[model samples]
Target chain A: MNYPIIVDVTLREGIADPEGATIERALPALGFNGISHVRAGKSFRMNIDAEDESSALAIAAALAQRLLSNPVIENATARSAAKG
Target chain B: MTRIGVVVFPGSNCEYDALGAVSALGAEAEFVWHSATHLDGFDGVILPGGFAHGDYLRPGALARFSPVMEAVAEFARAGGAVLGICNGFQVLTEAGLLPGALQKNRGLTFLCQPTTLTVESTASVLTRDAFRGQELVIPINHFSGSYTCDDETWASLVAHDQIVLRYKENPNGSRDDIAGVSNVEGNVVGLMPHPERAMSTLLGSADGRVLLESFVGAPVGAR
Candidate 1:
C-alpha cells in the first residue's frame, strides 16, 4: 500500500527562535495587532510504500527522528496526510 | 612529518584556507573528498568551514552522512585528532562526535568579525600549545554560530572540562559565551571561529598560529 505522510519539524520549546521572534516583532508594526508567538519551521511530504498505514507512519516517524530533525534542537512529527 | 587531512564537502569553501594555514605551519596538508571512505596514514583531520550541502535542512545535517564521515568517525575513535571549524563544527555536532548544537545567532544576523577568545582548556589537541586564560583573536563568519545544549548536557560538558574556548564578549549569544568545545577524550574539537583565517598578523592577527601549531605539532593519534 502507498501511504502519504507529512512531517513537520519545529524548534523545540525553550530553544531560542530568532526568526520567529523577528517575525513577531514585525507584526505589531504592520498594523496586525495581538498577533504573538510566531515560530518558523519546515515541513516535508512524501509517500511511503508499506503494508499498512501504521507501518508507513512508523517509518516516517523514524525517518523524521533520524534525518528530518536534530533531536538536540528540533522536534519532528509525522502523520498520515489528509486525502484531498 | 605530520600529515593532516582536510575533508572537503561539495560546498566547502575553506579547504584551501585550511590547507594553506596548516602548510604554513609546517604540516603536510591534503584535501580529502567527502566520498572517500577511508583516511589512511593521516595523523589528524580538519573539517573546514562552508555551506555543506548548501546548508540544506541545516548547516551540517546532510553532510553528516557523507561517506568520509564514517572514516572520520573511525579515526576519531582510535584517538586521532579531529578539528571542526565553523560549518564543520556544525557537522561534528550533528555526527555526534561532539556535544551541543549551533543555532541561528541571537539577533538573526550574519556575523563576520574578529572575536577575542579566551583559552578555557588546554587539554585538547587544538589548544595544547596555548596557556590557560590566554586570549586569541580569530575571525568568525556565520549565520548560525550560537551554541546551545540542554541543561543535562551542559552539566556533563562542564564536569568533563570539555569546554575549550570562550568568547570574551558573547558575540552570538552562545550559551555561557562558549566558542569551542572538545570531546571527553580531548581528541575531537569543534569551534565556530576561523583560526585558519588568522594565520598572519598582516591579515589581522597571528594568534591563530598558537592553535594551529598545537594541532600540527602533535604526534599521530595523539589523544
Candidate 2:
C-alpha cells in the first residue's frame, strides 16, 4: 500500500517567533487588518510504501523526530494526506 | 605541547584559522577529517566554524551525522575538552553535546560585526582561566546565531552555572543574552562568537587568548 504523508514542524508554544512577528507587523501597512497571530513552520510532503496507513505514519513519525525537527524546540506531527 | 585536533567538515572554512590559533598558542594542532572513526591521542578537539553540509535543513542539522561526530562525542564523554565556535556551536547543539539551538537572527539578517561578550562562568574547560564578569571583544559572523531553549532547560542551566558567556549588547537577541554555554560536566563548550578571529591585537583584539589558552592549558589529568 502507498500512503501520502505530510510532516508539519512548528516551534513549541512560548518560543519567540521573530520572523512571524516581523511578517505580522508588516501586514497592517499593506492594508491587511485584524491579523492577531502569525506563526511560521516547515512542512514535508512525501509518499511512502507501507503495509498500512499506520505503518507509514510510524515511519514518518520517526523521521520527523530524528531528522525533520529538533525536539528540544520544535514539535512535529505526521499525518496522512490521502482522503478516506 | 598540548595536541589539539580540529575537526573539519566538508564545508568548514575556519579549520585553518583554528589551526593557526592553536599553533600560535604553542600547542600542536592538526586537522581531523569528518570521516575518521576515532579521535586517539588528541588532548582536545575543536569544531570550527562554517556552513557544514551547506547549512542544509537548518545549520548543523546534517553535519551531526558525520562519522567523526561519533568520535568527537565519545572524546567529550571521556572528559576530553571540546570547543565549538559559530557554526561549530550550532553543530554541538544539534549533536546534543550542548543545550539549546541557534535560530535566525531576530531581524532575519546575516550579522557581521565585532561583538562584546561577558564571561559569565569560569568553570567550563573553555573559560577555566577567564575571570567572571570580564568583557571581551570578539567577532560574530553568521545568519543563524540566536540561542534559544525551553524554560526548564534555562532554569537548570542557571542553577548549574552552565551559561559560560553572554553578549553584553545582545546582538542577535539570544535568549537571556546567552552567547555561550557548557555541558553539565563543563567539558564541552559552545559559543556563537569567533574567538579564533580575535586572537591578535593587530586583528583589533587579543581577548581570545584567555579562552583559547584556557583550552590548551586545561589540567592534563582531565582528558
Give me the candidate number with maximum DockQ: 1
| Model 1 residue pairs with clashes | none
- Of the candidates shown, which would achieve the greatest lDDT relative to the real structure? 1
What are the Cα lDDT values of the candidates? Answer: 0.95, 0.93
Q: Please list all clashing residue pairs in model 2, or write none if there are none.
A: none
Candidate 1 lDDT over residue span A1-84, tens digit each = 899999999999999999999999999788999988899999999999999999999999999999999999999999899687
Top TM-score model: 1
- lDDT string, candidate 2, B17-111, tens digits: 99999899999999999999998999999999999999988899999999999999899888998999999999999999998999989988899
True-structure Cα RMSD, model 2 = 1.3
Give candidate 2's error at residue B25 in angstroms.
0.5
lDDT accuracy of residue B197 in candidate 2: 93
User: What's the DockQ for every one of the candidates?
Assistant: 0.88, 0.78
Error of 2 at B106 (Å): 1.1
Any idea how many clashes model 1 has? Answer: 0
Q: What local lDDT score does residue B88 receive in model 2, on the 0 to 100 scale?
A: 96
Which CAPRI tier for candidate 1?
Answer: high
Q: For residues B1-223, could you state the per-residue lDDT of candidate 1 as single tens digits?
A: 9999999999999999999999999999999999999999999999999999999999999999999999999999999999999999999999999999999999998999999999999999999999999999999999999999999999999999999999999989899999999999998999999999999999999999999999988765665
